[model samples]
Target chain A: DVKVTQSSRYLVKRTGEKVFLECVQDMDHENMFWYRQDPGLGLRLIYFSYDVKMKEKGDIPEGYSVSREKKERFSLILESASTNQTSMYLCASGVGQGIVLTKNIQYFGAGTRLSVL
Target chain B: AQRVTQPEKLLSVFKGAPVELKCNYSYSGSPELFWYVQYSRQRLQLLLRHISRESIKGFTADLNKGETSFHLKKPFAQEEDSAMYYCALKDRGGKLIFGQGTELSVKP
Candidate 1:
């Protein structure tokens, strides 16, 4: 079974603080995604990395950025955390470029609930 | 326009009652749809996908191309089934666009 691990489960930070949320996958999948889960709005993509040092902006990526220095780890960075950024953040990884059907199957991590106060 | 739409914000039912969660999408070509569920304090996970054509935990969803809908159905609801359900569509770019979600609450 694939395992995706997020560094933190709950975090609290003051406004304008820099926050980092880390995610690591054991399966060495080529694709990694970051999303913020909100009530009534569901999961909105924030950023995704298909390879080391390569990143793509998702639907909502203005205040957030991501890092993929290594194949197994992806990190989400908030340049300046705001109260509105408080939400559950999820990390997922999927098989890369082999079988189209399996590539869409993403294994997820326990979300990090960040509270920007 | 939203790529995926799950009209209901919440659905409540009693145990043993049937349940249906509606999902619709707008796309021009072939579409790949999936249902995902997140239980309380648990990570979100995939429930089933359209191509699989297999029932999961007594839940089944049929993709209707004519209607552009893939609704999840379960013959009987259980307390363990209560969760936030999301319908997602795999776009041409390979990214998954998810619906707003439907919170299913099965009462005892």
Candidate 2:
């Protein structure tokens, strides 16, 4: 089975504080993604990494950045956290090229609910 | 641009009653569709994919290109089946666009 682990389950940060959310996958997948879940909006992609040092912005990448220094780890960074950034963040990993049907199935980690006060 | 839409924000059904969750999409190229479920206190996971054309946990979804829809259905709703269901669309590049999820509640 594939395992995706997020470093934190819940976090609280004051405004303008730098926040980091870490994720690690054991499956050696080439793709990792960060998403924020909000009521009625579903899950919106924040950033994704296809390979080490490769990153792409999704629909809502503002106020956030990502790092993929290694294959197994992906980190989401908030330059200066704001109250609007408070939400449940999810990390997912998938194998092979994302275009393929079977390979595109993503395994998600238990989300980190971040509270930016 | 590719998009997925799940119109219903919340759905309630009695146990043993049939249930259906509607999903629609808009994409120009060949699109891959998937249904994902998030159980209470659990991480989100893939429930089923349209390409497999298989039923999982007694639930099935058929992709209709003509109608641009992939609606999930089950003969009977169980308490255990209650969860948040998301409809997702995979673009050619492998980026998935997910719709606003539907919260299903199976009442006893």
Score each candidate by Cα lDDT: 0.94, 0.94
Per-model TM-score on C-alpha atoms: 0.97, 0.97
- Name the runs in model 2 displaced over 4 angstroms: A98-102
lDDT of 2 by residue, B29-92 (tens): 7888999999999999999999999999999999899999999999999999999999999886
Q: Over 4 Å off in model 1, which ranges?
A: A98-101
- Model 2: pairs clashing at backbone N, Cα or C within 3 Å: none
Report how far off residue A88 is in candidate 1 (Å): 0.6
lDDT string for model 2 (A68-89, tens) is 9999999999999999999999
Q: Model 1's lDDT to the true fold? A: 0.94
Q: Give the TM-score of candidate 2.
A: 0.97
For the candidates in turn, chain A alone yields TM-scores of 0.95, 0.95
Give per-residue CA lDDT, model 1, range B56-96, as digits (tens): 99999999999999999999999999999999999777889
After the best TM-score superposition of candidate 1, give how far the Cα of residue A52 lies from its true spot, in angstroms. Answer: 0.7
